[model samples]
Target: MFRLAHISDIHLGPLPRLTPRELASKRITGYINWHRNRRKRLFGNILESLVDDIKSAAPDHLAITGDLVNLGARAEMDAVAGWLANVGEPDFVSVVPGNHDAYVPGSFKLACRAWRPYMLGDDKPASSAGENLFPYLRVRDNVALIGVSTAHATPPFMASGVFDRRQARLLRTILRQAADDGLFRVIMIHHPPVRGATQSYKRMLGIGRFSKVLKEAGAELVLHGHTHLETLYRLPGRSGDVPVVCVPSASEAPGGHRPASGYNMLTISGGPGEWNCRLERHGLDAQSSKFELFHSEDL
Candidate 1:
């Protein structure tokens, strides 16, 4: 079996001291929000413990869905780069950006610069502007991991995502190619694909576009984050229902709403058309600081 571990919304804390000029734009709003809400909600040490648990399991590959930093600052991205290094190398890890990772104008570009290794596909080389890297594909064993970017700068009080027509067209092509190879297609995006997954302000814009593509192209599985809650949603596919699984914030404290640092361990086997998969949810116990199985099911 090919083991894949998925985690998201790490929201690494202890924001680096920033110059007033640094926080002058949209970042200031994130700054206040981080201090007022997220700082208390996120736990850094607990994140390390969770990562350790994942490493102990020794999954063949790790997929992080995003929100690796608070402010999307250069320093924060740099810090997260170090953290990603400890998690695993590019060949062993894949990542997609979240709304927070693109908190302000140009933040996404900065993330592309810092987290390129984890985000770029083997066939797609880096561009000077770092703009067109999304929808990248990395094949591992019999699984094809396609990372899509929904992250973009939004207005204040809005935590939305956008997957434009360009990206959707690209995703459909990848899905087809991967399926042709008899690979288990797994799509990793930072935002939930369907509507009503979150409040209107935080919802993914143009979700209909995504749904249309998925309905036509089909995929074996879809994985996402951004709600900070554990959720499961199945969308229509050509052959059958596709399993969409969401992992809660990987650094969330234990007291908040579904506030458990957790991840999904997906065990996939079987040949191309007859893929057998089981998902096991593991969470860090508050008292023990160790991972415990909370849920498991076949996909």
Candidate 2:
């Protein structure tokens, strides 16, 4: 069996002091929001404990869906690169950017450059990691992992994601090829593609195009972040419902609308025709900081 661990929305904190120019754009709002709210709720110590737990679990591979930083600052991106390394090596960790990772115009590209090592596919060279190469494919054992970026800059107070025509085309092609290879395909995106997964201001655009692509080319699983809530939504596929799943922010403190930060552990056995998966959810306990299993189910 192959074990894949999923986590997202780290929102690594203690924001670096921003230059006036940096705050001139959309970051001003994020800065204020962080100071007033996130700073208190999102803690680095909590995140550290969570990472330790993940390492102890020793999943075969780790998939980080995105939002590793609070602001799309160069410093934040730089720090996140180091953080990712601490979590695992590039080859063992697969990542895609989230809405916050690309918080402002040009930030997404910057993040692609900084986090390139984690984002690269097996076919791409180290130098190619900086480009906007979406739908990157990496085959590991019986699993075919595809990284899709829904991360793009948006106006202030808007945390929406986009699934453009170019990405859609690339994704459809990748899905079909992976299916033909008979590998258990897992599509990693920053936003949940299912409708009503999030509120209007934070909704992911291009749902129609995305669903159409999925219906045309079936996939085994879809993983995402950004909602900061553990959720399961099934979307229509040619054979059966495709599972779209997410977990809360990796840095979110216990309580509130968002549950405590956690990671999804998916164990896959068998193959294409009769793939079996057991999902084990682990996270912070409401009354204590100890990491423990919160939910388990077969999918």
Tell me the deviation in Å of residue 150 in model 1. Answer: 0.3
All candidates: TM-score: 0.97, 0.97
Q: Clash number for model 1?
A: 0
lDDT per residue as tens, model 1, 92-127: 999999998998888888999999989888688666
List where candidate 2 sits over 4 angstroms from the true fold.
Answer: 129-131
Question: Which sections of candidate 1 miss by over 4 Å?
Answer: none
Whole-model lDDT, model 1:
0.89
Q: CA lDDT of each candidate? A: 0.89, 0.89
List of clashing residue pairs for candidate 2:
none
The alpha-carbon RMSD values of the candidates against the true structure, listed in the order shown, are: 1.1, 1.1
